[model samples]
Target chain A: MNLLLSSFSSLTNKVLMALAGLFLVTFLGVHLGINLLLLNNDGGRAFTAAASFMGTNSIIKVFEIVLFAGFLLHIILGMMVSGQNKAARPSTYVVSNHSATAPFSKYMFHTGIIVFLFLLLHFFDFYFIKIGLVAPPDGIASHDFYSRTLLLFSTPWYSLLYIVCFVALGIHLNHAIQSAFQTLGLNHSKYMDAVKVIGSVYSLLITVGFSIVPLFILFYRH
Target chain B: MNFTLKIWRQKNAVAKGEMVTYAVSEISPDSSFFEMLDALNQQLITSGGDPVAFDHDCREGICGTCSLYINGRPHGPLKGVTTCQLHMRSFKDGDTIHIEPWRAKAFPIIRDLIVDRSALDKIIQAGGYVSVHTGGVPDANTIPVPHEKAESAMDAAACIGCGACVAACSNAAAMLFVGAKVSHLALLPQGKVEAAKRVQKMVACMDELGFGNCSNTYACEAECPKGISVVNIARMNRQFLAANLLSEREKVVNISL
Candidate 1:
């Protein structure tokens, strides 16, 4: 019975956490490449082609279901884990600060919230419109979705929002990426340092890469 | 240096507690926090009040008994230190310092600041020992650990079984304490035979004690008086995951064969 419980517990949360986290990290690399298309002119031929392929691809649809499950599982497990944490230490923290603590620990829930909002915006954006889940709001043409993304960037506020969200994504990735490997028992310092650098670079690329789309459309869109 | 203290006092474990105020005048700034508390107790005796009860031993910081949440920080806002080593000089004249026991469900307070930290002792008992037989001492060099490995082992061994890591953790997880114990044993040649069993046992004990899981918050490392590394926690994870997988695979192989 104990073995059963332990095995189940490990598989449900810890194992899923690792798998989802690694899967999401892959999405960062691919998504970054796709996002870089905003650098193109002529109302986003590159953007539309990539968007259509992603939208119509049968394999991506299956992955999309998995992605959705992964997102919910990750968020739910994160909360359960945090809640368990709060229950264990019911006492209040008195330290004004602890530098030895990782920066990720403090802003965990906050970053999770920001990332969730970013996903919602992204879904309403390409997922909903591109896939026909819902027509683009404000009579925005389907082909003009790229231009819509560009025009949204025309407002500094919209650009600022994406930049801020991406920054949060970067911070979240900084801790999450390497943390996944640690969970998977990859703790050797020789290799872990390389993982940290990879995680940091990947996080930076995705965040900065996605944020740049807004800046490009805001500045260079003709 | 005279000082006023707001100490958290509870009649018993069943009762809810609050910060009952006390004044300890003419305190020597050089005296450790526990010594300052001793002075306050002396005054309490004279005034016909209950002496404040807190845990301590060895006056040195090694015992991990003197856990305090000074001001708003564990072990008094200082880094890489414990409550016993904390001096009155850390506080100023007329400062309203808050004192409380380690706050956790697993560590029930017996009275005042004295908590039943045997939960930690229980964790150690689960996997903290080696299975040595009754025999004469082996040769000094019979099992020689490499310098680097021995040093690393010693680093983990530096843990004094203190529950400060639990207090410092937002989740009140005992991962650092458990990690320290696991790393100390798992790295040495003497401990390899039992590494898998030790980690599985210790981690199970920790979880059973109602301590939370590790989230790599690294708070335990920060508040630890020994500055026990978060790397130790990672090491512990590696040990546990590898042990479970290896043991499981062995069982499967045996069954198949």
Candidate 2:
């Protein structure tokens, strides 16, 4: 493993980072699908049943470990790559112009940092409770993510922060999906434009899909 | 036209650099950017001052010898043309232009607005070549290259090895330059013989040269005087990944043996 890592070039590092990030992208889709069950109007029964299955399933336990590893690799590689990139230019131009590229491309690291902070909050809210780290709110079962999610979203401030983080995640994904395709060399001239469009649409869907739950809970559930 | 120029001035590679402002007047708008610089240099010589040192060879823009970061844009504000081809008409009278050297760890500044671009040549020396027997030149259409392949190869071949891509990239990455070099040759039959080895060696060299990783900003493509597309970068990525995978698999086989 050490020999393999030592032999990997900068391009290889980027490829690995892109692969990890794409995995996380797919994971977000699964997470959103499960979370959408919160709105089944069945008083948390459907959502809790699905959440309980995910928590207790043996396969999902293995997948959870893989998911953590993916996040760790993505974050570590992202920081290393960005640090080296910064060091590559010892000096900066007095007048810098980046008008030629997408405005959000240069800010991926910034948005990544924001999303990371939000992840800490999210894990504290839910993952910690699942593992008996933090006690579930009064009278709610430790495994009952459904009531916990609604309880948290019912707070106006918490819902607002959740929506804000989703926006940041959306911005990050707007560049990340297409960038991963480019990094992986899957981009072709004939289809690159289409890939870019798909990336935008996918990001928009994730942002809106996740934000709707909080908005629906705060407005309708209350 | 008259203008104020804030040009970086460095005596040598080890010397500290600073932006020194100068004024030039009564310049024709039709004069090339180099002509304007020449006028300024002439004035400096007559006034007992050191003339600014800038690189230039062919005034027609093909020779990639000239490099300047003018008013924050590589090769001046014009697209698809080198500094030698940029005219003074692009700027208005009394405009204040900022001129600086290409800033990259790989391409260190040699003097004011001039950097040592031998790093690019080193990458080329790594593998950007095709091995053919020394004999009479082959017939033109012997390989029977597809029209699309030839056209795309030509597009990639248009890169002039100017470090503008490095200058324009926020990370100062040379992926575009290396990608163009790799793509032009890799697309042709003659180059396919060593495509795997070529990409591996060049990429290794690029990484060792302190260049940054590409983040897909496409700034290099936008600032490239030849209008080289980032698609060449994608091609290089594909080539590098495939080459590395094959070589790694070979390593596993060798270990088993």
Candidate 3:
């Protein structure tokens, strides 16, 4: 109701970025758990049930709106933060040293862009198909999200792209997990080490968990 | 010690600047960094050359005026110490040291190795203090502050406003400096009343003045001469969030029977 809600500050922008980022982080876990159902030998039976529930559930439908809003806000705020950061230093140092900083921290924008591109391609491959804007592959039910995912992963190029994007996702999450906490003001001296450790474990889980599925489909599913 | 110095030299704030090399030999290892620079200045004056202009006051490290970006690190290759406190003994004989000014759009160069850090003062002016009436000091024990919060506030109060945090940060963010000021005052009973408004105004001023957002690089904390912890940055963020979210009073509705 005040100017604070309408206006922006550096901290406000960062808080938005962190909240949206953590929300997306939670979504990644849910997504990875659902996608892991692909590994079952029941020909996508469990995966289809879960996927249909996700697609049709009312609560999830509301969450989908929230999720897209989060993504949009995160992206817009990210771009503004990056732009302001760039403007803060118009001239580059002839010799800059970033040895003290985390190696992955420097490439956040690069990895984020890669992830964005991957998300777009992923949407085209699956989401666009579900909305009926694109035709489904032969012998696949229009609602058979599992067969389509399997077929997409079956392609060598598609699988390679997925793996590459997953690696980028891992790198992004590695810095982002702990960074989100620090941004959200959850950092403390006593628990800092634990936060970092948990962040790394979560990042690894997301990366390895999602990545193995594509490799499994590409190499062993036939 | 004999050392080759690559020093940035500029005639004025708007002039083009470049790194000029000078060799100084027979320097005492016991000489502080600023003393060595003084020796160099004497040699330059004697040689009829323009002496390098840098900022320094209270060579004992209390004043945050000695601003030097040395060897890609702020305040030379030391942690928890300012440029004035660094000694020549830290560098080996015949070593080459690079010195530059703290560079940022907000902190423009005033001269060689000197940047005008008034942008920090501006941020402080925005809301870095609590408004108070002119009156006698309150009894220290009257407001009982927990030992931990007092110690925490003191830790944050140690910030010297040296601008090293901005220079060390890859994005030239001033979050550490602003965080220190905000956190220090926010923790004290005298400062709690205005804490919400203070954080909001200070943060907005920081963004408006062209300081970047912190990405949690920890560089600011690493190169901070005062060793101000990023914990203060987190604390400032918490204050900001609380202010942004909870400071407003919502309107109450009256239902008719």
Best candidate according to TM-score: 2
Q: Report the alpha-carbon TM-score of model 2 versus the true structure.
A: 0.95
Give per-residue CA lDDT, model 2, range B151-225, as digits (tens): 999999999999999999999999999999999999988898789999989999999999998999999999999
- Could you tell me the lDDT of residue B58 within candidate 3? 92
What does candidate 1's lDDT look like per residue over B42-109, in tens digits?
98999998998888888788877788777757788788888889988888887888887888888988
List model 3 lDDT by residue over A1-222, tens digit each.
223433677787788889999999999999999999999989888999999999999999999999998887887777777888888887656568643786488778889989899988888788888888888888987788887887888888888889889889999989998998999999998998898988889988998999999889888886
lDDT of all predictions: 0.79, 0.91, 0.88
Candidate 2's residue-wise lDDT over A1-222, tens digit each?
434543568998899999999999999999899889888899988788888888899999999999999998898888888988999999888888643996489989998999999999989899998899998899998887887887899899999999999999999999999999999998896898898999999999999999999999988989
Which 10-residue span in candidate 2 chain B carries the lowest summed lDDT?
Answer: B248-257
Choose the strongest candidate by lDDT. 2
What TM-score, over all chains together, does every model reach? Answer: 0.89, 0.95, 0.92
RMSD of each: 3.7, 2.8, 4.0
Stretches > 4 Å off in candidate 2? A1-7, B247-257
Q: Please, what are the lDDT tens digits per residue for candidate 1 over residues A1-222? A: 223324433323565677787887787788788778868765679887997787779998898798888787777777776676677876664434343576675677689889988899978876677667868767678646676776678889878988999899899988888878777667786888899899888888888788878877777663
Clashing pairs in 3: none
Model 1 stretches astray by more than 4 angstroms: A1-12, A93-99, A138-145, A191-198, B132-136, B248-257
